[model samples]
Structure formats: structure tokens, C-alpha cells
Target: MSCQEPEFVTAEDVGGFDDLWSSYGFYNEGCFEKGAPLVLNDQQLFSDFAFMDDMHFDSISSAISVAAETDQPASNSELLQLDEKSTPPLPSKTSELLSKYQFKFNARSGEKPNESIERGGSKLSTEDFMRIAASFFIQLSTHKDCNPFMLNNQFGLSFSGLSSAEIMNVELAILLFSAAEKVSQQRFDHGTNLIKECYKLCSKTGNSVQRVVYYFADALQERIHGGKGTVVKAQEVMKALLSNHPVHLATFRSLPLEQIMQFTSVQTILDNLGSAKKIHLIDLSIKHGLQWTILMQALSNSSSVDYVKISAVGTSEEEITSTGKRLTSFAEILKLPFVFKPVIVSDIKELKEDMFKIEETETIALYSSMDMNTMIIKPDRLENVMKVIRNLRPQIVTVVDVEAKHNSRSFINRFTEALFYFSAFFDCLENCMRGDERVRMIVEEDFFSPGISSIVAAEGSERVIRQVGIDVWRLFFARYGLVEAELNQWSVYQASLLVKHFACGESYSFEVNGKALLVGWKGTPLHFISAWKFQ
Candidate 1:
């Protein structure tokens, strides 16, 4: 199962629309093309898992069993040390991979998701919002037009080894900081003060690990956004800010929309008479069981569905446990029979890492809310995922991932585009204000210096700015014969929330430095496409 074999294909192999389409079996067969590739026919992807074409499932079983017996459980102190180990070292091999695929400076002329103009309206649609949200990751992974230096400038500064969580730590920090800057109040006083405070706290507790930096950065950004202008650095004041400061990382599981949609979708699908018996919910990063909670509720309400079991897999036990707790709490609150099993994996090699050996293939269904490319970027890994999908022969295989392009060609543009868009947001706002001093201070002092966008633009940085992750995911899905479906209701709810809370009644269409950009609240429905495998 070692991916020692290298089958590298140049961008030319799959570059042109016609060439790429033919190579991937997209144009020839209509089965692959569909709406956005949010989640496609679940059955097709997992159907291959049942076919054991020299797949070493037994090997995985043996390895898992051995690991279970030989592994010594780490205590609290050991666990804390383990957390420390999560911080990845700088100059990672993946850093180059990231740098190669920067965000693009694509025109923002594309239609907004579910936006409307009624003096007040939703900004996007459920389908479009999901696509956009997913696109965020796509832009991060594939686009190449962005500033690549940001990765090093921000989180890549230092690291022992970069784990997926560490990468996410940096990404999450950048995302939150950017979001805060866009929506924060008292930009000048609050933003700077928060950054300084976070810096001091990190110094006392730990160094500038990606997680710490991001956490502090995000918190400061959030506080500033919340209109908190307190100026007290953690160390200089010689006093603690609070009696007890809890780690306040915003969990995606907390997003009611995602939670509700996932649960509802699973239940709705399973309740159908033709639905399969066994159901699986696969998520790349299961922070908490918030998603499963909703699923559990939906399953409970279903008249046909009796017992729904969940196998929630993530990168680490900490993540699994966090998700498990959410599922457990949901059960406690609703009093349902929903059991969520947790499986922790460090890399894609572990997909079958501990899969139990069986004499014959099982009709197992698979679902994933993660980047499909993560499993396929490497040939062997990609084949492994495909092998698993083929073997399971699941009636359904719903995969949710960023569909952005990070291939050899579009890497630079992706990052550049992201930087441009972020810069544009601030620049547009600044222009609107006629160059306000406070705005300038916010941009120059707190916003510009260490922003993730800025980091991507830095020299030798692996970071790239991209439009968003969701759109790229949709395209990727189409390439793979996964049919897109209509946007889920939860997405619609999120779109509504953004419009209700964050919409500004200003419609201005202007080119930013020759790049067409659209800024305003127009009632244009966010375009969301879903794909299905008709075959």
C-alpha cells in the first residue's frame, strides 16, 4: 500500500478543455457532467469498494489491530505534548506544492449566490453558498495566480512538521482574520491592540506556532469586529485579562446550516424505500458531532429508518472525540439511537488503514465532506480512494470537497486572484470612504502587514489567494462524473443570514485595475449546480 510508485503527468497531459475532457472521460460520457459538484450520487463512488482488485484490506486490518495493542495511551501531559507536536515545521515539502498552486485573479463578474435587491434581501442561495464556501478551499489548494509567499509569512514561519491540522490552523486563522477585518468595528484601535495582546499571550504560553498565531489573530480580529477596543497586552499589563479564558476556536460543526443540512440530507435519503440500509457519513475534518446531531434528529423522525449508525473519521483522536461529544450531546438532547464511531487517520494512506477483513464485499455506502483531491492528488492515493470506492459498491457515495484547480497550470493565478479580491474588498471600501485616516491606519497597521492575503504575496511564500474553495470543488466533481444536486436548505439559510446581517445596500460595478469586479447586493440567485451519475 505504499505509494512509492510515481506516475507524474504534466499539465499538458490534462490541460486543454477538449484534451482534459477526453482524458478524464468527461465529454465522451455524459454521466460525469452535472450541476455544481457539491455532492454526487453516493452509490457510484463507493461501488468500487466492494470489488477487491488486489486491495490489501487484510493488511490494513492487521496493521490496525497491531497498532491498537502496541499503542500506549498518552496521559494528559502526553496529550498536551502531542498537541504541541501538531505544529508543522516550516520549509515543508508540501509548502512547494502549495506555492505552485496559487489563487487566481479571476474577474468577480460571476453571479452572486442568491443575492437580491429589495431594499433588503439574501446575498446568496443554499446551493451557491455551499459552492462558494467550498470554493474557499478550492481557491486555497489549486489556484496559482495568488501571492505564494503568504503561507510562510503567516504560518510557515516555523514548524517541526506540518500536520493537516497545523495546515488548517494557519488556514483557519487567515480566514477568520480576514473575515474580522471585513466586518470589524473600531478598525484602528481594536485591531492593533488585539494583535499585540495575542502576540504577548503566545509568547507566554507558546511560540508563534501556526495554531497559536491563528488563534490569537482570529480572536483579536473577532474582538475588533465585535467593537472591543481594549488595549492591554497580556504581558506588559502584568495582569491576566480574565479569570478563565477558554479556547474559543470557531468550529464548522457549530454552523447550524451545515449541521442541519447534512443531517437532513442523510435522513431524507435513507428514509426513502429504495434507500440502502447501512449509511456512512464521511468528513475530512470532523471537528465536532454538530453535523451528526442533525443527522441523528432526521433519522429519528424518519418512520422507515429504524437505527442509523455513523462512522465519523478524522485526522486525529482529538478531532474524533470532539465530534463524538457533539453526537453524544445530540442523542442526550433528543434521546435518539444514533451511534457515531470515530476513526482517526493521519493521511490518506490510512483510508483502509484499519479496515476489518471480510470474506466478501459488503454493500457499504460512503459519504465525505472533504476534498476529493486530497485522496487523489497522489496517483497511488488517488487509485487507493478509487479502489475503496469501487470495493464498497455502496448504493450512494456523497463526497463534498473543494473543486478548485491546483494543477500545474492554474496555480499562480489562483493565489493572485485571492489576494486581489481581498485587497479589492478593502480598497473598494477605502475608496468609498474617500481615503479616511482610520481606514488607512487599519489597513496599514493591522490589516495589511500580516494578513493571510499579504502573506501569500510575500517572497518565497507557499500561500496563494483564490476566489473561493466551493466553486473549484464543483468543477472537479463534474470532471469525475459526479452529478450535482440542487442546493440544500441549510445553504439557503446561511445565505439568508449573510444578507440579513452583512449586506450593504450599495451596488457598484467597476473594474479594479482593469479587472472586472461586482460589488453590491443584487437579487441575482447564486448559481449552484449538482451532479448525478445517471449511469
Candidate 2:
């Protein structure tokens, strides 16, 4: 080993081999001779027929969707658009109706309004805060403790009592509870009054008891005023992938989400491959290169293959370069000759055959872990790309996609679906991510917020995070002349082990849908992993 370089044993020393091959030249010059476009082999049919299924953004609508919960029906008139005409006057009987509830406000029993509250208005007491908070929490689909917590709903938000700040929290919570159309609309009207009052009291900053006034203020502008809070920089969105900013770390490290599902992605490619002299894997989008490292170690443990080459493609040259270096280090640790190819693509139009260099008599596999479909933003481009892929004739192509109806063209439909989808995601975090409030906030603010913001606020090319379900993806692949291939049963068994290993056995479940596996929390599907071969 060189003085500066890290030293490691040969693959043979660890895996019962007598010799290890040296790193060959990066590209296979011999196979550059282009072959005529290969025809889709129809003889490779696996399943006869199968069914299928289906992120956040920013915008005026996105703003409301993010800060304002949509438990009520939303409409152009009903939605609080600040620039629009003044919101309707608060219902005269609203306070009276609310007083009928079992609130028992701690307004000194015999005193008048001014004696109870300095401002001479009927301000709610600390107990009132808990009652209000409980109301909205009960309507939540996420939050594991929603029901159990509701059993003892008498908890206080602030002992002193209500302020515009706490009122803002209550208003926000009301929006969060997804109620029926009529109820949601009613809540929107009531919440609008709270928004107005909160802003009116904004000048008296001291009265804003909740320490986080700006958060509430921002949401007010976004939700009630139809304000698109802030335009998120594209780089910031991508940076979230690496940021240890609580959100990314929680998502990047945890179980049933990033780590375990990532394990499933790697195993999908490794399972049931016959002996070959060399292995070539092409990743359409290598955000972290995590799966490759896990795969490299697993490959090192086996004596089946000799050379491994990884061609990583992404929008960032830096990420691709970084991933290459990391993969190279792992390969060296196993004393294996590994090649990492970095392909930078600024647009889907940049995708071409030249990005992939075929090697003579080598086994090739393609992976699009939560990638590919995202790049197919248009029909013509998607078709052309599929044509390009069809020409590669890879041994297999593995795809993992988010399972939600989040890609609809209609903004209303997309926004509505996002609420339900992310609610479940948050619930997963709450039940599964105990003692990690900071992580949850990060995931919600930085990760979920930005994503939701993009989906809600952005349009056209800015909306790159659009995702569709696996069933739709099956049809998409079929157009390229591909069929779903069953992941080996061993890989299926590994799925259960991954859950148990994560110590989240009770929190997650897996289903083998034909050859595809749907791994999700409780009964809700989060992601699907399936492999494909020529149809």
C-alpha cells in the first residue's frame, strides 16, 4: 500500500479466493462499436397481466396546503385570499356556540371581562388552550397518540391563557384536521376570523405568547393572503439530500424509509444473477451512492464476480464525483478493482446512449431507485428515453417509486392528495421516531415543507419532483417493451429481516405483489420495488 493510501486485504484473502484482479481501464473500448438498435424480445414474457397504482411544492395553493390544513372544503371564494375582498364577518353566535362546550374557562368566577383579562375581552385560560388543541388533534389521521391522547384531552398549551400566537396555533390546527366538505368550509370561515384578529394584534408583539410568531405570521400570509411564502432555490431543494439539518438526517438514517428501503433496492439487483466475469451497473440518479456501498460489500462477500463498474448519472457533477470517490474507497477496502463513471445531465434531453459504455461479455443491470420516472416529465421525452433504454438490452432494470397520487396535472387534485400522503408519512415518524422531535421538525420544515412548497408553489420545469405510482410506471416501461420480473424469493425473505433488524417489526408490513414488493407503514404503502426484463 502507498504511504498516503489506506491499505486493505485482497478479495481472495477474505472470500476464499487465491487472486484479485487489478483495475482495468475505465472504459471498454472494444465494445464501443455500436450495434444496430435491438428489437424488443417478445419471448421473455413473465406475468400475463398485472394491475398498478400512484411530493410537495410551493404556490399560493401550496401555501395554504402547507400551513393551512384542508379539513374543510376549499374554493376560490371560501379560501382566504387576503388581496381579495374582506373575509365575511365572524358569525355572531360563534363564541356563544363554542361556550356551550365543556370549556369551563378559568375567567375568575365572579369577575367581569376586564377583571379576568387585562384587555377587557373574553380571553381563554390555559385549560382553554388544551381543549382547543385537542379539537383539531382529534381530526388528525396521523399522530399515533391522537386517540389515546384524546382520552385525556384536558392538557394546557400555555398556563397563562390565549394570545394571538396561541390563537394562530389553534387556527392552524383547525386547518390541519381534514373534515368533510361542509365542516372544512365552516372551519375555514372561523379560522379566517382568527387570522384577522392575530394580524390585528401583531403590533402588540408582547401579546403574542407563542415564541414562534414569524412561523404563524408567514403561514397567515401564505394561507389567508394567498401569498406564496418564499420561492425556494433549486439548489436548496437538492441540498436537502445531504443537509444534516434535522429533516434530512432523520429521513436519511432511519428505518422503513430511507435505510431499509435502500437495502431492498440493492438486493433487488444482486438477487439471482448467474456467474459472470464482470458486472456493470448503471444508476440513473445516484443522489447519495449509499445503495452502491452496501452492494459492494455484499458483492465482496461472494466469489461469483470479479470486476464491478458503476456508472452514476445525476444533475450534479459534484454529487456524482463524490459518490464515485466513496464507492472507490469501499472497493479498495475489499481489495477489488472497481470503476466509477460520473455522468452529469442538466436536463432530460441530455440522456443518450453515449453516457453508458458497454463491455464485452459483461453482465449489465440498471437501477432507478426513486429516479427515472421523475425525469420523464413529458410524453415525447419519455418515449424517446425509453427508446434509448430499449437499445441497451440490460439484464434487468429495477425501479422504486413513491406510491401516491401526487402527480396529477390539476393543482387542486395534487394538493389534496399530498395532504393525505404526507399525513401518513408524519404519522410514521411520530410512532416510529420517538425522542426525535428535532428530527421530526426538520423533516416537516425543511424536507416536507420545501417539497410541499414546490408542488404547491412552482409550475412547469420547476416542478421536477412530480411522482407517479408503480402501476403507472409498469405501463410506462411496457411502452419501452419491458415486463416486470419477479425479485428472487431470497430478496423477499430479506424484506422481513430488514424490518426486524430495524427493530420496527410492528410498525411496518410488506406485500409481494406478483414480482414487486410494497413496503409500507401499517397498511399504507410508501414505496414499491420491482425489476424488469424485456417483454
Candidate 3:
């Protein structure tokens, strides 16, 4: 919640991207300091207990026992009865429960569950299991007075009647919780054992729940064993992913979320530039530069536009060069005079105004998508990046990022938030991809899995996937003398139309939060795109 001015370190002080990746334990300094733990009084505890009356507890107990003992899957009628008796608490009630129990639940409003569980035949859906298991684990993990391993004896809970899949997921959640607890307590050996057990039940190739649990377990294992090798391997995966244009393009096409971001960002840039004849774009993390193609095509139609230049900032020279070639080729086909400048940098904080070679006459616009969050671990670096942008005096800056609160200092809080956030995301993928397992797996494993690992496994500065909501970003940007540039109504309409073009796109919804545009699945806001200009 506060920012501490740390001594700035130059690129030479920190070796390169490899060194930055290898180094962990960089605290956020004063920013996002862990707040004092909430203490629950006896009266508050009684009130919370009153909310879960005897009928609810009895129904939950009966359901657990029935699910554990029965060989056949529970019928919809039976499940519905149980669900009615012991329904998952609503978001407000859930927060109260977590608070009373001395746990934190800061999941976004978009992550709230629907009024009713979406029944899929006799068996519970993966998402349903995730919700149940997450709640169950919360109770088990926070009960410091009782031993979680002896839940049957200590809490009178049974795992007998549930389906095999349900049992597997619940067991994995328990193991993961136990392992995380051990890691936090610095009991590496015990945590490692629990992690191994988690691996036994988890599968990256299994259902969405299993895939996510598998990655969480992997992260815990890495956390226990000093994750240098894991970091190196992740870097390799990212490098390969960035260099592969076809895969990137396919991902961009398959996922409407990316297109929503890219389209909205491009539209915002075009709208803000007016009739500028010469425009320069500075992309902070221009992986494959696919977004610019849309901008170039838009500009090609404008008679007043004379020249377009894109100064792409990235880590890999080869990848940037490759992206330049593609964008250059696309520009030629459109008959637009274009230049692609690859502004390669070892670290984003190393970015300087001189590297961009800006002109006095050219109108400047900056774009960032899922990039700024990485710089968050180091506040000074993030500040420096912001300073660079502010100094550039861009006409407009567009930013699109995943919308979630995953920057908590508390592991369990962050873990819970991530569980819900990714649960919604995975559900979105399942609905959108439908039968295309291959593409879904590629997107999940290649693009998202690394982020999950970083969030769960790494700690301090090493934990790089520190995504926050727009409210936090608004405050951060405001400190750097940037103000929100309202996105026009047409951009919102265009984004909605783009969503309709996809098969399951109707599930995706948009909202204009102040000047920003939020695209969410169902009711959950997964991403937000907003424009900014210097104050």
C-alpha cells in the first residue's frame, strides 16, 4: 500500500535477464506490505457458526459420507438435495467465513460463483469439485487446533462415497495445502513428501483441475528445492514460445481474450492519434508483434497517414528481428510506408529515451499487454519503466492485462485467489475450445503454466507473476503523472462484436469501468484494457 524509494540499480549492476531470472527474494519493499492479521472475537466466531446452522453441517456431513461410500456416482437428485442443504456460501458470506476463521479471500467480483452449480450429469464437473475442494481445504488448513491428516477422526468427515475423480481432486487439494503449509513453515522434507504424494494424484494431462493442481504441486516442489533449474527451463520454454510465430498466431486466433485486448488497444491508439500523419509506436513487450498488424491495416486505409514506425522493445534480438520481418512484410502488402525498429533490452528498467530515437514531429503512442506485471517484483525497476514512458510524452498509452489479485504476501491468500482466477480461466478455455484438446493444452501449458508456477512456487522478488486489479494500476500510474484516457463507446462496441465472432464468445462479457474496458467470462472480469495520457 506504500512505496519506498529504493536505490536504483543500473543494467550493469544486475547482469542480464538470465541473472534477473535466477535471482529471487526481491521484496516489493513498502509496496503491498502484508497487513496485520485479523483477530476474531468469540462473539464473531459464534455469529459465523450461527450462519452455518445445524442443518447445513449435517447435510455436508451426510454428503461427504455418501460420496465416499458409494461406488456409483451420486444421482442428480441426491446431489441437488445435498447442495440445497449445504450450499456453497455466497461471495459476501464466504468472505465473512474466511475472515472469522483468520483466512483471507480477496478473489475478484468476477470470480464469484453462479447462483446454482452447473450440473453435468451424475458426476460433479471439475469446476464444481474445485469450488467444493477449495472451501473444504480452507477449513482444514486453517484449523490450527486440529490435525488435518486425521480429518475423519478429528472432524468426523468421510471421503468414502464420492466418485473416484472427486476423491482424487480433494486428496490432491489437501496434499497441496499441506505441502504449502510445510514450505511456509520451512519444513522442506515434510513438504517435499507431501508434494510427491500430490504428484501421485495430479496429472498435467488430466482434466482442468488436475492440470492446475499438477502445476501447483510442481511449484511447491521447486520452492522446496531451490528453483534455479526450474527457472532456467521456464526461460527456455518462453524463448521457444516467443520465437515460434505460427504457434503465437494460432494462440492469438484461438483465444478471443487476446484478440479482445489487441483489438481494443489498437482501436484506442487509432482513436487517440486523430489525423497525425507520422505515428510512432513503442511496444514494451512486443513478442510477435501481431497486434501491430491490425493497426497497420487500419492505418493503410487512412489517406492522411503518411508513415508508421514501431519501436519494439524485447529481450531476444532474434525474436524481435523475426517480428520486424513479419510486420514489415505485412506493411508492404498494405502499401503503407513502415519501419520496424527492434529496441532490444536486457531488462525493461534499462530502457532509455535515446534507444527509441523519437522525433519531435511524429505522434507517439505506447502499448503494453501482459508485460508490466513482471517488473512489479522490483519497485525501482517498475518505477524506472514508468518514468521512461512518462518522459517519452506519448500521445496515448494502451495497456491490457489479466485482471486478478495475485500479489499478496500471504501464500495461502495468493494461492486461493489464483485458484479461483485460474478456475474461471480454465472454464473459459473449456467452453471456448470445446473439442480442441490439443490447442487448449498448448495454451494452458505453454502460456499460462509458467505464470502459475511463478506465482505458487517462487517467493519474494522471485515470484514474478504479480498481477493486480485496475484500481491498483490506476493508483500506480497516477503516481507517475498519468491519467486515464476514456475509451470511446465505439471501441467497446467493436470489442463486443469481436467476441460474438467466436464460437463460445457469448460467455465473454464487457463492462466500461470508468474509462477502462473489462472483458470477463460469464461474470468474472479476466482482462481489462485501458488508455492513458500524461497528466
lDDT of 1 by residue, 344-386 (tens): 5665556772352321322244555433433332335544554
Instruction: List CA RMSD, all candidates.
Output: 20.7, 22.9, 18.4
Please give each candidate's TM-score.
0.40, 0.59, 0.70
Higher-lDDT candidate among 1 and 2?
Answer: 2
Candidate 3: tens digits of C-alpha lDDT, residues 317-380: 8878988998999999999999889998887678898899988889999998876665555555
User: Which residue ranges in model 3 land beyond 4 Å of their true spot?
Assistant: 1-127, 138-171, 186-193, 226-230, 233-246, 434-436
lDDT of 2 by residue, 89-162 (tens): 11112233244322344544654322323222334322233235433333221232332112223223221333
Q: Quick one: how many clashes does candidate 3 have? A: 12
Q: How many pairs collide in each candidate, listed in order?
A: 111, 24, 12
The list of candidate 1 runs beyond 4 A from truth reads: 1-278, 353-365, 373-379, 402-412, 421-481, 486-534
TM-score, candidate number 3? 0.70
The local lDDT score (0 to 100) that residue 35 gets in candidate 3 is: 29
Off by over 4 Å in 2: 1-250, 301-304, 376-384, 409-412, 456-464
Q: Could you arrange the candidates by lDDT from highest to lowest?
A: 3, 2, 1
